[model samples]
Target: MAMTSLPSLPLLPLLLFAIAANVALGATIVKTLPGFEGELPFTLETGYVSVDDSELFYYFIESQSNPKEDPIMLWYSGGPGCSAFNGLIFEIGPLAFNITDYEGGVPSLQYYPYSWSKSTSILFVDAPVGTGFSYSKTQAGWYTSDTKSAWQTYQFLRKWLIEHPQYLKLQLFIGVDSYSGISGSIVVQNIVEGNEAGVVPRLNLKGYILGCPRIDATINDNSKLIFSHRIGLVSDDIYEAAKKYCNGSYDDVTTSEPKCYEAIKVYDRLIKDINKYDTLEPKCTWASPNQEEDMSRRALEETSSDDFILSPPKIPDMWCHNFNYAMSYWWANDRSVQEALGVRLGIVDNWERCNKSLQYTLDVSSVLDYHKNLSKMGLQVLVYNGDHDLTIPCTGTQKWVKALNLTIVNDWRPWIVDGQIAGYTIKYSESGYRLTYASVLGAGHSPQEYKRRVCYEMFNRFIHYYPI
Candidate 1:
């Protein structure tokens, strides 16, 4: 098949069936990996869901406890471009790179005790079109916008479920780390609509989970200034000046009044030395001048390859977090690792954690309306933020959640784990809709990367309908 053009709407289902009729459902049951020793304890399945001319790759791990009854969550890493391996290895998955012991050639992997998959089956997908192992047969297929990406993902899920009918009855929840929330919300809403429209296999749509998500680009970026001031990164004098001159909006100071522009320049200088992702971490020296400029913008308006700084510095202890990201490059690029994972030969060259170079357009500025629509549907939601993350500050999350105007059911209180405060949380409800909001104490962007155990505890409680 040429796959020269995308399948038309009328012919998409037939195309899906045609692809599924072939053996194996385009999936591979990965028994062993290059760095991990022995057979994997849980079922690890990797596959490509053919969505028209695009091959969306995914890694599905069965629940460690009981896949038969537990909820199934479909997760994708943000950057709209970051590889799903980021979620699989760094954040919520069972395997993690042993960065501390790395003398490095195909970094060693160790089992993470706090993986969310311990309780729920998780499907981690490389989305949009050109992320990770996912690829497009035609140049046109590689191009995607927020609306198109969401639609493609919805199609991917339906086709995937069709191939694995055992999971058809499982309650489905969408989980997104960072930026994917825009599309994730759209995907959830799409799932609901598809079910109501009597779309095949009727997805048991539940709700969604968003971690330090980018909701409104302007609002999120502007919140960074407030977050920085609140966290003591900006001096009171400077913050006050900026607040007064910038008129409470620091996102586009360049075109603002002269005083406002000057105030913002000072504010930016104050924060220039700090690692905005996690204010507690040291600034990365490995980032190029261009990457630093990109970081300075604090905008999530467009996907860029610079989203993740790939190279690890020689001195690991200085910036251990970014150093850890480098392990994925080392591991994924290895011939043995690719062979073990059943990666198609030569489809992708030099795997990137986030391939922002793909032709992508950020069409949706804010998904707040989508959230409002979902709120009326009687679904549940869990929204979390790392208290110290300036990238998409907790303050911004609070502002938007408050906009929903759901009655506060459970007043704000400290949520505990091991008898110590893990974070603060509040619950809101209206009609049948319920939303839980949390802030992970002292963590940064993507709480799971910094507080895996705490995040797992929070997720465990939320998934089981227990209060957090």
Candidate 2:
């Protein structure tokens, strides 16, 4: 295949200014955008599943890609309450709609300036119930939780595969942020173990990929401390003070630590008062003079706050304040429209509520014992993390993987691509798969959005050329 070259630009002052403006605005340009123009159309087959007398809405995205050698990747967002379709419309898929103009009849699809459809079929599912367009009307509390939803999602995938024989050989489960680490593991484990026992027919069974996955809840809890320590958010002395208040308990420490609470209170007050502050989407960008003034206002606000709050607040503070986290809130708040389907959100919600009747098969024991159980079933596991993400810091992930005590076949070292610090890589050959630690430069939680080229390369390495 011939490589497409980037468009050449003349070395002019205006061009330089435009480049500088983009850089200043922190806008990322994806280099390898696909050639297919306009909205990548799809046919949605809507259905309902009866769960506890409630009808739940569920639908799948059938990619309009030719040759279709690229497998179907089931994408889920985090929040356990978030929608997978949001991931489809905003992040990776071919076309995204602007929901800001919903009242206006002008319906337009914004082509992904960069898309991943060239190499894979994408399926964005609204899982459990009460998330996105999925909801439970009769069984109000049926689909409100996480574990039960995992089971329903697994069954849905199985049935979906059977119905769509064309995609049976090309199904792969993939997720990122929170669900990628949690529910994603459940889906992969189900396929692997079921295939081994001869109870469930194995589909294509390609390996899974998690971008900044939130796997272990316990590990994620501790990441707060690690991030606080790495960045100068809280001094070592302040952390020690907060730790004493926590009474050595990691659970709910944020509630116990007065000093930590004070820190957060101070930070929040500062954040609130920062000039040019936008509550919905707070970007870390302002003119230098305005930034200084904002910083001063923040300091004053922190100083004025009283120090006697119950627990320290843990605001979402990170060095890189990208839009990934902010986008989640915006997407979740949109309870009226379906970006992927180009229809009212009401239709989809009904289907999700019906599917609320499904239940989870695996428990905490199964999740904790995932590595051992899945390996025995001949399934390969890949756990990956981007190093720079303070949200799901790489250090916490390292600690969790090390505690797993899986035999290490490949030693830990930096995985470099094109002479850049792409990330670190590790492998456990005895376990029949490789574990990669990719460090995406200038990336926060969602590396795919921030570092697309490197992320694509890593995906190609793992999915296309495994066992290397």
How well is each residue in 221-269 modelled by candidate 1, as lDDT tens digits?
7888888888888899998998888888887667538999998888888
Candidate 1: RMSD to truth: 4.9
Query: Which runs in model 2 stand beyond 4 Å of their true positions?
Result: 1-68, 96-107, 174-176, 239-249, 254-366, 375-377, 386-390, 416-419, 466-468
Q: Which predicted model would earn the best lDDT?
A: 1
Best model number under TM-score:
1
User: RMSD of each candidate?
Assistant: 4.9, 16.1
Q: Per-residue lDDT for 40 in model 2?
A: 42
Tally clashes: model 1: 0
Q: Which stretches of candidate 1 lie over 4 Å from their true place?
A: 1-25, 285-317
lDDT of each: 0.82, 0.49
Q: Where is the poorest 10-residue window by lDDT in model 1?
A: 291-300
Predicted structure 2, TM vs. truth: 0.64
Question: Model 2, 346: alpha-carbon shift in Å?
Answer: 4.4
